[model samples]
Target: MPLGQPLRLGRHSVFPPLLMAPMLDITNRAFRTLVRGYGGCGLFYTEMLNARRLPTESAQSPFWQGLGVERDVMVQLLGDDPEALARSVERLLPLDPFGFDWNLGCARKKITHWGWGAALLENPQATARGLRALRQATDKPLTVKIRLPEHGHPDLFKSFIKLLENEGVDAITVHARTAADGFKRPARWDAIAQVKSWTKVPVIGNGDVQSAADAQAMFQKTGCDAVMIGRGAVGKPYLFKTIINQASGATEPAPEAAKVLEAMLTCLDTALETPKGAREFKVFCRYFAQTLPVPHWFWAPLQSMTLGPELAKRARVFFKK
Candidate 1:
């Protein structure tokens, strides 16, 4: 159960097999850097990009910013058109990501309204064709994030996943809920088990993993090759380090509030290095706020402050108290 094992995805191998799920607007460079620094995430993904927008420099440009060549990162793209997706992949090759992942399972209404995301799951044939086109476009690793189908026989879900394996997808990450279920319903970890039984590629289980024990139970119950952390890591990048230590049978000291405060400031400094970074710092503060155990007395004043230096000073005083 050591987290050092390598996970083979087609021709590539990722150590630890723990990926930071591609959360839109939350998994940017500063956040990713903070997670990696804590030590456990094997891969990080960019915010979802649009295939149609990839051709233009302005649209494609955001995906390329703040990423380092040394980091293991993938660009997750949302689109329904196979040709357009292929062209986008072609355009992205020069940027040299660790891989490319197709966003098939995002249940966002705005995304599906444009004929993308989890709506693609409703049409398995088109999803297969899109995966094939993207596979042909690049030799880099390709993965599809999927949600378990709602109101279906288990056999039907198996059939859909088989089609993805048949089409040469490198791996599949199952989010354990249908589009209809939204975030309200409990994630179907049983469905993840069913998908693992059906697929030959690496299966990654995602959803409702909030603790190291949950991470272990996911792997034990589903027999998945990996586990992907989403909202669970927000305000707690140390969650990764804790999980890794637990998996390895090592005892890790509880991260002190002071240490957590330092990590947050480091993330703020990293975010502020970009254009309009102070604005992004405010966004980051929203997530960091979740980690505070006390009442709003600290965050209320910090939120009102506009300057980065002022915010950092307030944060130091808050943590000291």
Candidate 2:
């Protein structure tokens, strides 16, 4: 079957319902722009910004710079402080993002120690209070991304999500693993379908989606409102187009190596616009390398170059037939 209808995020509607997942350092402006060129992704997310730190972040910091502001971008927030997050949302309101998503799926000890991310699974009351604070602060579409609770009955999980809906959350993206499970276990699509059955709010299923077929299967298997692409989109943004086409019952071959090289070059040039952009270029290329038919042919030289310009030049020469 073709992909479902447009997904409504409060007043906003995103067609095709394929989203580029909120990756910490990878989903910056340059990368989102590169993905946009290939088409299919309906929404882009900023790197998860620290809600408490956002007020103090410099206007020129990498966190604030080189972002795809033109697209339907969702600015994701990470933190446990309800008041601080409300303050941060107030500050961010002027940017006019399509929405905001709370990060409740990150399992890193550094974040969990602060009672944030996956740790919030242990304190549903905090999650409720934070969402209430955010709801009071803005009329923008507010959502949360979560891992399944590390310890909870299915009924408890359902009640927690019901609390989110009551607090005015526009949607929820479930990562399908419990906090303790991290990514070691396969994503439980069965559980995602169960979550879908529990709530009226649009559910976006994330995790283990690596290709067009996988995207199609996630939607079919889970009956989710959408599917999110994370690690899979790093090098293959065109993967979105593939999924979209396949979902529509049309088929398109993956892009040629030359086209992929051109998009990667564009990403490099865009990253070079900022101060530490060379490092950004390297990070993007590191993932972009994996998309190649024989990645090792280009990985060594890409890895050796430290300067963005040099990397771009070598990439051109290497990809040249």
Candidate 3:
């Protein structure tokens, strides 16, 4: 797949080449809808769901909660057990999602200890077997999210990628850093370029894409098919529009702080429909604070408030400045 081309991933084809990365606790249905409202995100992924929990009947389960079938959403599952992962996919298929993604790039310690998330990257054979199981279990498009090798062993990385390709993964999103490196190290765009050289499958480069210029630079440097924005999309939903405009040689009005706040409030309203409405609102507010120019005096009080209306009023007041 070339950098500016439409890449087919099983039943779906993504154009303009962008995806909203599956962010834990952040990329919920409400946030995905908010990004979609801004326009230009080619695909949207839900937050990572534990494969084990998907079988249980719980209202709070991320898999069961806040799922809106109307949007282009891919549900991401995290688990080390091949059977458990496969069974989870079978259960999720009835929802008729755009596709499914296996998460192999989260570096959180709890997930790593369970042999899930980025720990799967340490064992290429296990990862390949898991992919095979997932491929056989469901006809939906299968994608994997991976991080760059910490030891920089190109041969081993290529072998792992080849296993995914052989197993018929629709696409792969590379976070561009090793699990050990976390988010601190700069994304290795050159490594993505190397992967692009080796694979014909759609390769989506992810990491540190904060602006349209950053997206352009990643495309220019890596020659990958698409760009996936994670934290950068938070409090800045218009980022997708900006990137698309830049790619098409057009310009858009810069997103003002007030508009960003209004979007956050809209996201809050949607999130409130879910079980952990209050807690999720707090998480969203924390990120929104980062995007606003409000003083700590304003944010501190708002964070401590239990009332949603109070928080919204405070946010509006701060944004008006």
- Which prediction has the highest lDDT against the true structure? 2
**What local lDDT score does residue 184 receive in model 2, on the 0 to 100 scale?**
84
lDDT (tens digit, per residue) of candidate 1 on 184-224: 99899998888888878889899988889888888889888
Per-residue lDDT tens digits for candidate 3, residues 1-321, read 123777578877887578998877677766777788889898889888888878664645554555535447888999978888888887777677888899998888999898888888878778987998899998878999998766647798898888878989999898998887777789888889888888888898998998888988888888888899987887677788888787677887977878877876776674554446555666666765665565778867866776666666776787777
Each candidate structure's TM-score, on Cα atoms with residue i matched to residue i, is 0.88, 0.90, 0.91
lDDT of 3: 0.79
Q: Which window of ten consecutive residues has the lowest lDDT sum in model 3?
A: 62-71
> What's the distance in Å from true for residue 197, model 1?
0.6
Tell me how far the alpha carbon of residue 151 in candidate 1 is from the true structure, in angstroms, after superposition. 4.0
Best by TM-score, which number?
3
For each candidate, the alpha-carbon lDDT, in order, equals: 0.80, 0.82, 0.79
Error of 1 at 139 (Å): 1.2
Candidate 2 residue-wise lDDT, 113-169, digit = tens: 999998887788999999989889888889899988878677888898888888889
TM-score-based ranking, best first? 3, 2, 1
How far is 99's C-alpha from truth in model 1 (Å)? 0.6
Q: Which regions of candidate 2 fall more than 4 Å away from where they truly are?
A: 66-69, 268-270, 273-275, 291-306, 313-321
